[model samples]
Target: MNELLLTGDERDRAGARLLALLDSYERGLPKAEILPEPDRDVLASLLAAPMPERGVGVDALFDRWEDTILPNSTAVAHPRFLAYVLGPPNGIAPYAEAVAAALNQNCNFWQLSPAASVVERSVLEWLASVVGFPAQAKGILTGGGSLATLQALATALNDRVPDFHANGLQRASAPLVVYTSVEAHRSVDKAAAILGIGLDNVRHIATDSVHRMDVGALRAAIEEDRADGLRPWCVVATCGTVSTGSVDPLDDIADLCAAEDLWLHVDGAYGALFLLSEEMRGLMGGCARADSITLDPHKLLYASLEAGCLLVRDGAKLRDAHAFDSSYLTVAEDPLMTDYMDYGPQLSRNFKAFKVWSALQAFGVSAFREANVRTLGLARRLGEGIEATPGLTLLAPVTLTAVCFAVDGASDDDHTALLERLAAENVALLGPVVVAGRRGIRACVTNHRTSEADIDLVLEWLQSRLTGRR
Candidate 1:
């Protein structure tokens, strides 16, 4: 008998157990604690456990998962899990993930994973169409937004820097500078530093009142860098900033990039997929004009974790940046398939696109659109409630699904205490933010399970707790 393979009867039993587990979890999620209090003894026992010479039967394994693991894990899928941009996986995610694991497609090459290659390409095409990219556009699924941004910057360097593939930064006469807004994610700076661009070469431009990148400041900074004999290479714009969900001025920035001949990479990992909503198209349409953009499928698409994408307007440039020849790996190109090894850095990539495509196929696009629209409405509801309350202040506009607000005259310590109390009482799991130097709480309604009632319940609890404290 194969040591690793399960017997037919055992497989059947495991499948039934998995289905029961999923059903029970979904049914009990609402009543469960958003964050569970871990038992120290149980954790200690788990850590002290050693590898057994004999295998524990599948039945016993399932028992351990249900009795110990399930109770200790955070209920991230809970409707009131409003902490970050994270959203729970859709109903079909777990099934799709299991199928993908069983198939084990190595999506790096066309020969090894023909169907996976087609699936990924089709998914990318659909995404590009949503972003209004032309037919020539090409992209690859990534680990997440951070890696996507890093890959985009690397592509920019390969295209802009003289002899980049041959000599890299060593041949440059002066330092090359990258510009982004002060509100941009830390991934931008991290990408630059990793690419040998150095933190000193990155310019954090000022922002406007609504927390968008100040275009004037960005333009002036670019010119100033040129005047100082520094090479201005790329501009990283944000579609939705982390704190306030503010979108940078994409049209104006695209125009500036055109005039300046600089690469424009929009970090839309948090908000680009909002384009599914007809209402968001006008605000996020500028994504099409970018040379490259990053998107996180796990965020808006509600796929399982670690699903991201990087799209490049000029598909040839992306390949030019990373493609290398190897005798053992070389194969005749097929017209219908993409050799993903030429697209990005990975050569042993998994089938990350299957989960995304499966969900879209299972639920259709309209379902996601409706869910996004609902989240937007719920955010507006929460914002209005906060504004109407006597002791609360809306720190920033409800741009997307993130509602940032502060308690009137509340100290940072007080805000921290309030957040802890809310989590401990299981009212909601909100995140903390500092908007324009004021410490505040942020409730991001990204979960599809979130409802009008959930929003109202959180508001009522907050109002009661802060009734006279204001």
Candidate 2:
């Protein structure tokens, strides 16, 4: 073969086929019933089989994806999909992802991906600006919210402990403790565990009646830990508790951190991006005060899977935590740009910023703001509907998109059955939520595709189910 991997004609043909496949999926969204109970046999056939002796061509792969793979995936783009806190990707993601793959920009360093580095910086700056942080704030896009939180915790660990990377957690004189509400995401605990911070070191602080973290109790816990000679270093606050969409008292948490000289890390993965709307700015103003914050672009920016960012107010601290020089990988960096390899654990990163920036540009910031506001409105409507229903008891405050409600005389098994029934009938897919040790059906309106009509249909489904049971 000559010095070529693929001929120009072959490349063009592949591109054309990809474009066609994408077009077909986009067109299928409209009258597609929003969901279809997946044929488990067909799905198992696709995944259960091992690799073939001969590779499947692009055409066969595309055919397999269309025929078998897609139906099993949750149709988050469907207007009726109001289950988990998942956002459908914006229209530009498919084309942008294709371009990113073709270009194969190594975003770990400026020398390897200059334009990509700048574009990522631009996207991060825009995100920081929305949170009312200054230009000095710095961040990097990671795989998703969990990775971002993991990176943030690692950075905090580095900042508080001297020579952490060298000695590791084993040599530390005192074990550091992290405070978080019981309502916090499991990602916090997962990150702590991954970083060698024992589970016992994590303090599951109690929350108030409304589910926000109890700041006074947190202070007491920290004081107790300190008195016991254990180091209390960081407090992880959550913006959206997964079960109830309850936002922690950020202002109070920030004040407590300031008084205690502790790192304040806000896990804003499910809720921070709402700051795009002016209406949410007042409630989330204290986000600017956080030492570091984690956000999920896949959830809020509507970017395709695996776009999360960890933003830090002090850029130098992030660098201090992650940057290290090695003979094999050393390279010069420009003052204006970031060598992102110095910012996170991964060195070979994809050009994730292109898809995020492309989506934002194609849809505009106003569209996202309106979409967020619409979701908030839909959640409030859902809460009111649940309250008005004869047998339904609104379990928690509808602070955000998550609506949890208990049906009279329904056991946890009843809720599980009801959820399956809803999904099987294509009424609407809702999961279960546990509130005060009792299980209830949870419908979260996180998708921008979800409309008021969809909400009413789900309510109708509930009514029909209740009548059938009676």
User: Could you say which candidate leads in TM-score?
Assistant: 1
Instruction: Evaluate model 1: give its TM-score.
Output: 0.98
TM-score of 2: 0.95
Candidate 1 lDDT by residue in tens digits, 227-329:
9999998999999999999999999999999999999999999999999998998899999999999999999999999899999999998999989999898
lDDT of 1 at 281: 86
Off by over 4 Å in 2: 1-13, 30-44, 47-56
Global lDDT for candidate 1? 0.95
Per residue, candidate 2 scores C-alpha lDDT tens digits across 1-470 of 65435467666777787788778777876456556767899977867999988767656777787788777766778777777998788888888998899899998878889899999999999999987777788999999889999999999999999888888787839889999999999999999999999799999999999999999999999999999999999999998889999889999999999999999999999999889878887778889999999998898888998899999999888888999887677677587778998889989999999999998888888988898999999999999999998889999999888999999999888888888877777778788899878789898888888888889988887877778752
| Model 1 residue-pair collision total | 0
The global C-alpha lDDT for each of the candidates, from Candidate 1 onward, is 0.95, 0.88
The true-structure Cα RMSD of candidate 2 reads 2.1
Alpha-carbon RMSD of each model:
1.2, 2.1
